[model samples]
Target: MTGASGNVGRQVVEQLVAAGEPVRALSRDPARTEWPDGVETVAGDLVGGVPTEAFNGVRALHLFPAPEGVDAVVAAAVAAGVVHVTVLSSLSASWETDSPLQRRHTVVERAVEGSGLGWTHLRPGMFMTNTLAWAPAVRAGEPVRAPFGDSVAAPVHEADIAAVAVAALLDPARHAGAVHELSGPEALSQRDRVRVLGEVLGREVRFEEQSRAEARADLLRNPWMNEQLADSLLAMQERTVGVRDGLVLPAVDEVLDRPGRSFAEWVADHREAFTGPV
Candidate 1:
């Protein structure tokens, strides 16, 4: 699995291991990852060197994109006899759209599709785990602030996302050629999410909305986050497409045999993220 040390990717790796699957985890730094026993580790899958050395005899993969050598890596995965490729894609990917993140990720998807391997794309919406970004402020008793407070999203749990990814990778019969837009069971505004966090933690945490200018100034130092991706996410926050209108899916249940978790439950599980160790 590429990006095995990352957020959602980390959960995928843990789930794969717990399910008794032999996992070969790839990261940019092999020594940095502390994987479970029997899991192989390698570095440099998507950059200069081809790390397909670990892919030899592998039957499945959960892929992510990097700055370079994706094509060569895919080719080597094919030569290594990989049967299924499950890509960790976003909900924003539209083939005809002209967004940079979408453009680049779609290019990677195309490479996988053209590689003649069985593939499934997991398109998850905003992650509930993203709220952990506000944890430090919550711990400090400061209002959680960001642009687009009025925007709504189905804030999906990362565990649910990983559960579905495992289902797709291990059993492709129902998910092949399908795009699953994973989300939480309920639609919530940013303010509402903060309130829920406060409730779960037994503290009345506050939330404030930042203007676009403020967001831009604060994020200027983030070299990896370009303006286009930030703007697109902000816009999605402002006027969300799928919400109470029920554009959501039962894919999680169909794949994992259960409905996705609600934000309240997510907050409860992650109360420690806001409150820290006792």
Candidate 2:
């Protein structure tokens, strides 16, 4: 599985291991992190060609969306006898808008679609983990600040996203050619999420709204984010403010046969992030 060290990918690795599946995990530097017993760790960079040996004897692949060299990776998977592929994609890719985020994921999705292998696209909306960035502020007894504090999003847990991917990988026949749009069980405004966190932490977690410029500058602080991508994300947040209709999807429940986890549950599971030392 590519990106085996990432947020969703790590969960996917854990779930696959729990199921007794022989997993060959690929990452830029496999030695950086330890894998479970019996997991075959392969050092391969998706952007720089994935080593052919990584796909050897592999039946299905969990793919990460690294646009560079993606087509070649799919071709290599096809040549190495991979039967199915599950792509970690974004919900923006399924939207009608042509934002950079959508276009970026779309490129990878298109490559997988034409690969002649069974494919499942896990298009998850805003990740609940995005709020992890607010941990420092919460831990410092300050308000969690972000733009579009009223924006409504059903932020999905990374676990649910990975569960769906694991299901697709294990049951290719049942999930092949499927596009799963996933989200949390309910839509909540950004402020509401903060309130939920407060309830979980037994403190008054406050929300401080930011201007668009401030949010854009904050996003640009990430080395992985460019101006175009940051602006695209900000635009998405701006558009979703107070949006209550169709922001949530049932694919998570249908695919996993369990309701998507609520934001409060996510907060409870990650309470330490906000309560830990600075």
If candidate 2 were superposed on the true structure by all CA atoms, what would the RMSD be? 1.0
Assess each prediction's global lDDT (C-alpha) against the native: 0.80, 0.92
In TM-score terms, candidate 2 sits at 0.98
Best by TM-score: 2
Those runs of model 1 whose alpha carbons end farther than 4 Å from true positions after fitting are 94-97, 241-243
Candidate 1 structure quality by residue, lDDT tens digits, 92-205: 674355666677677778888899988898878788888888999998888999887766777788989888889988897767777877767777877778888888888789
TM-score of every model? 0.92, 0.98
lDDT of 2 by residue, 152-261 (tens): 89899999999999999999999989999999999999899999999889989889999999999999999999999999998888899889999889999999998988
> What is candidate 1's local distance difference test score?
0.80
